[model samples]
Target: MAMIELPDDKPVRHPEYVYMDYARHLSGRLRRTITGPMWHGPSLREALDGINAADAVERPIRSMQTIWEIVLHVTARAERARLRMDGLALDEPTPEEDWPRIPIPCTAAAWEYSQAQMATAYRSMAVRVCEVMSSGFLKVVEKQSYNIATMSDGVAEHGAYHAGQIVLLRKEIHSRRPNGAHVTDLLW
Candidate 1:
């Protein structure tokens, strides 16, 4: 059989309708998924609403990550994306750097700091995205398997995906409360 050689350059994936303000679009999405009054339900920040440091650190099941760990993970990923957008040319994060270690003696202050850190990372990434959008995908998209546009979309998707996990975790925690309190009993 004869072997066929593939071309080095793959086809570009510019969308049919160009986004004039794509930066703002993705940035708003990032914000909504992070903290919201989203139409479907609570955002990531909303999911964590009223949860204290103890609850953030509480592992409902031995196998699952604590909310605090999840927050740090999300923040790290966002920061990674921002760095890449900023032209750092980073590869994937190492396994040890994947999920950050939650600090010992986790206090209310630490929890708040984690949340704030998450917000700052997202905001910074979002601002960098504006520059990417303004610059367009011509030269940029070629370098990466996934371009800025797709990566931005992934960020939004990732946040919402984790937000759902946080929601389920909350229900599990609430269900196990001493009084048998149910998250199902109330709107979270």
Candidate 2:
């Protein structure tokens, strides 16, 4: 079979390479940071594990965001990164888009929907990161401070930051459970 070479796009990960390539490494890091087994602490998914709708909507601290709002914001950021991979000329997300208000009457079904949307968005962003060409990683989008590689790192960092927040909030809510019914078994 004749190997066809594309002039404009060279993949960062070559199948024959014994070691992992740049894009694959970045992709793995991004995935782990968002999804778990991270060395530093709980991943985003782990942080939200077992949280019900009431837990999701609880604001343990005054003026702090609910777990639901953080999930929505993370989803929005992930979606933004995915769209940028397709060369979308998107500007910074508006305040509403960044941290969308939680819907009134947030039911269990609605909370489930938010979680599903967040998972899908993060997965899509990771897929895009894994598919970037070597050159693509170096090419910065106009009006953006980070290149593809750094931007993807930012996604992981952003997720980790929010995950920490969620974990703390979860702890606060758990601590207040009646009759000393704290979540003593929480991994985080």
Candidate 3:
């Protein structure tokens, strides 16, 4: 593929090359939106960084859910979509699965494990997205009406939405601290 330099002096694949390898282009774009630095703000991984178990489990507002529950919920949604994309015959998520019950004590180990699970689910989703893109078959087998490209984009958007919530919850929790510490101090 030929490279063309734009006005900004950034070389991009030629138009012809892009058209010929549209699937690869789509895969790359989806991957970047999911994990790479986006114009809006931090990606999902960045949003969860440095959050301790106490912070994860704390419900700053009685009506709202904890950061841990939100993370698990996001993970469940993404994993379910990924499974469907992979042609797996998994049952639809129940309300309990959608909002998973956080471990009673919310220990550091459990918090870390939840984080790992979220990361793993996202990674799996990304892999399936690439596979769908590479196969040049955007339409998911399970849902004839929906295409993988659209679904992948939706998943990325979903992650960003949850990430924003996590940020807001972190701020709320930090502001409520007894020592009156700033949330900015807790964030990187």
Put down candidate 2 lDDT per residue, 116-147, tens digits, no spaces.
88888877777787666543766686568778
| Candidate 3 local distance difference test against the native | 0.73
Candidate 1 segments whose C-alpha is farther than 4 A from its true place: 1-17, 137-143, 182-185
TM-score for all models, in order of appearance? 0.82, 0.84, 0.76
Worst 10 residues of 3 by lDDT: 25-34
Alpha-carbon lDDT, every model? 0.77, 0.80, 0.73
Candidate 3 lDDT by residue in tens digits, 1-188: 68888999998887545534654554554455446576676666677766799999888878878889988988888788787787765566689988999987789999988888887777777666656654544555463457666666677788788778887778777777788766553653
Error of 3 at 97 (Å): 2.1
All candidates in order of TM-score, best leading? 2, 1, 3
lDDT of 1: 0.77
Q: Of the candidates shown, which would achieve the greatest TM-score relative to the real structure?
A: 2
List candidate 2 stretches off by more than 4 Å: 1-20, 184-186
Residue 129 displacement (Å), model 2: 0.9
How big is the positional error of residue 113 in model 3, measured in Å on the Cα after superposition? 1.0
Error of 3 at 125 (Å): 1.5
